[model samples]
Target: MPRQPLVRPGRKLGAVALDVSSSHRAWLDPTRETYLASGRTLGELGDRIPLAKSKLSELLRGVGLYPRWEVIHRLAAELDMPSWPLHRLWRQAALDAGKAPEWIDRSTRASAATARRRPPLDHDGLRQLVEHDYRFYAQVFLCDDERDIAVQDTFAALWLRWDTALCSPDIRAFAWSILRATVMARATYRDGRPELEAAVFDTVALQTQISPSAGAARMTRLVELFRAISRLPVTQLDTMVLLHLCGFTAERASGLLGVPLAAVRADERRAMRHLESAVTLKPDTEGPIT
Candidate 1:
């Protein structure tokens, strides 16, 4: 017996085929009408929207590709058009492709009200940005408590300096600069003193279960290593941690540290030498010096 095709030739299963080349033309009609009513050329529209001219052409021609949610939102904001229509189209496109929509759930009405009330730097936007970057900043500081305090303080400072930050070409970079500076300043203040008062290993018992004797010895060595790292000069330690541990490039480390590239490299070399000389491992001894 011959099995029939689920979709017969020349007959779409639905009102329109979900394919980009076919369904996109109809789906994009509303947006296209809105674009035309605005009395702007494709290039002019592209200038305002985040999409490129070529991409815009493809979109208008009913290409199946969907723009990111942020791009869609930006388009709606710039076009002075309601966002729901575009969002619906995007959702449908995703469904047609058998994939989940990459939309971040947020209240559209609330967002519109926010725009009407003030500029984009409201409490919600700030909170979202901070939450997204919290882990990155935490890793850089290597202390959750200090990172939290620093993030809060940095946001406070940024709010006060919002006007200046808004004028920058890259707002994210500007915000990061302020946050990094605050975190580094806090770190600098705690330098030359005992930052870690006690052993900071996580769950000795868990490690002991894996290898009882070796686990205890490794824990002691780790504590001593951390103590040694704490005793290093602020510059060397900051450079070493940012470049080596945090996986930042030399250029990025230099920018964050407000030092020259040569200085960062020099500090890294000095830091390695200092650590090797400070922490000695005796062949007969089982662990590092405490």
Candidate 2:
């Protein structure tokens, strides 16, 4: 009888499982040695980089760099410290000497083969974005340049393609921006429509939060919010997108942006203050501005 190949269990989604191959371990040793030359820990390297500790650890271990030495080497390389600074020197030399890294061409070819296998964005975060705010629809629209036709086309596509695997947290965050842009553009279009007076009604309709017949008064309040948003500067748009539309808490938004939580909170407050100053209540008995 012919010998049978063994099938290994897969790692949990959003995480890299350890590769127990001997060749993988061998490849990581040199990287480990490089770190020893630079003198830093993997945990220390993780602190300076964008990854969380567990993720950093996983990135190292999956490539057979775990067990300390390999971690340190990657840190040194990531930080451009000595020992593994050869990579940096090579980059600089390539620039100064009018050449490229020796592995660049080869690596690019190899990377292209594996690139398609990777997932797009984290799943859990994506679900949260959809669950929390209708504002996300606007953000996504904006990324595509706030064009109604484009936004609607994209939304129609995503709405049709919705699935559980598409709900990663990272993917959700990414989509949040796109949705915001898309909704904003749609809102802009609605503002100019003969039947609609404010972007809020458009935004609400974009999210499907209420029926089309939700009444002019409710839509007017939504319009008031949009007006306040419009008065804010473009520089603060990211904060507004994350805090208001995406419905990310201050802490989570801060973590996602790699800024201090206080900064996120302060920006949220500032955005709200600006909105409060901009809104004006119309009399209940009065008709909406046509």
Candidate 3:
């Protein structure tokens, strides 16, 4: 089969290592039954295997293993939940916590009870989850399309920046600026994204102005602009948003992102190259525009 092009635009490629675990093996792998028998949560198993806690949690949640089962059979087979009197034990615990009686069957209340007893996240963990799951600080600029949701979901999945140190006023200011850019990009999607991005880069004074042109004309301009830049990959998109859309100085964007200034400069060049490529790749009107 042919490989798919890396379709997600504006994603950071190396933010989190894919090989976040020190051990090559997965406890959930069929060969690792002995390791799984250690009777630990994936988080605990992650510690022994030297996987990042966040990565481990993501894996478990992705596979539908978290929240412990409300059904005993599911708990046993799907989650490898403990075999001992699991149902009665957890059920009564749930009753003690005053959870709804109908929420648990008699056979599985014990698991729910155990789940209720768990404590809340620490401040750092809560922040990490927000950043990782929601892409709290990442920004995106997109042309109007029904497919825009895919871009948003891609950013949300890749975001992993969660340092409480960023709560300082200066850093918070920077974060807010990025967020505002993302919000503005979304707000303008129905109008024109590419034209907005071009104005942002080439004429800052024009960026905040929505042209007095009629809506359809404005949308046409935006579509033309996005089409002009479509062949660029993730790096150029990142640079364009930081420098043009967000109005960050090149030095400032480089410093905040910890990338070299030259890399940022190269990104602008690469973006132009992609625009040239896209212009030459004419669209077939008979096919759906993607």
Q: Which structure among the candidates has the greatest lDDT?
A: 1
List the candidate numbers ranked by lDDT, top first: 1, 2, 3
Candidate achieving the largest TM-score: 1
Give a tens-digit lDDT track for model 3, residues 1-290: 21223333232222223432211111122112322333445455445545555654454333222222333333233444333323333333344345566665543554432342221234234334333312312323433341243233222211211121243344433333333343343433433433234332233323444444436645455546554543345457656656654556778656554567898889877776666555443342101112
What is the clash count of model 1?
0
Between candidates 1 and 3, the one scoring higher on lDDT is 1
For each candidate in turn, the TM-score is 0.38, 0.33, 0.36
Residues forming the 10-long window of minimal summed lDDT in candidate 1:
7-16
Q: Model 1 scores what on Cα lDDT?
A: 0.52
Q: Whole-model lDDT for model 2 versus the true structure?
A: 0.43
Clashes in predicted model 2: 31
Clash pairs (backbone) in predicted model 1: none
Runs with alpha carbons beyond 4 Å of true place in candidate 2: 1-212, 281-290
lDDT by residue for model 2 (50-125), tens: 4566766565455333232333344544744332222322233233333454434343343222212212243334
Write model 1 residue lDDT over 1-290, tens digit each, in one string. 21222322231212222454322332355455445445566566678775677677666655545545565566667666545444544444445555553343332332442232232446348557454344453444446675675666455445534545566664555666666556665553345453442323322222233243455665566556556766778677666555544456788766654567899888888877887787664442222221
Worst 10 residues of 2 by lDDT: 111-120
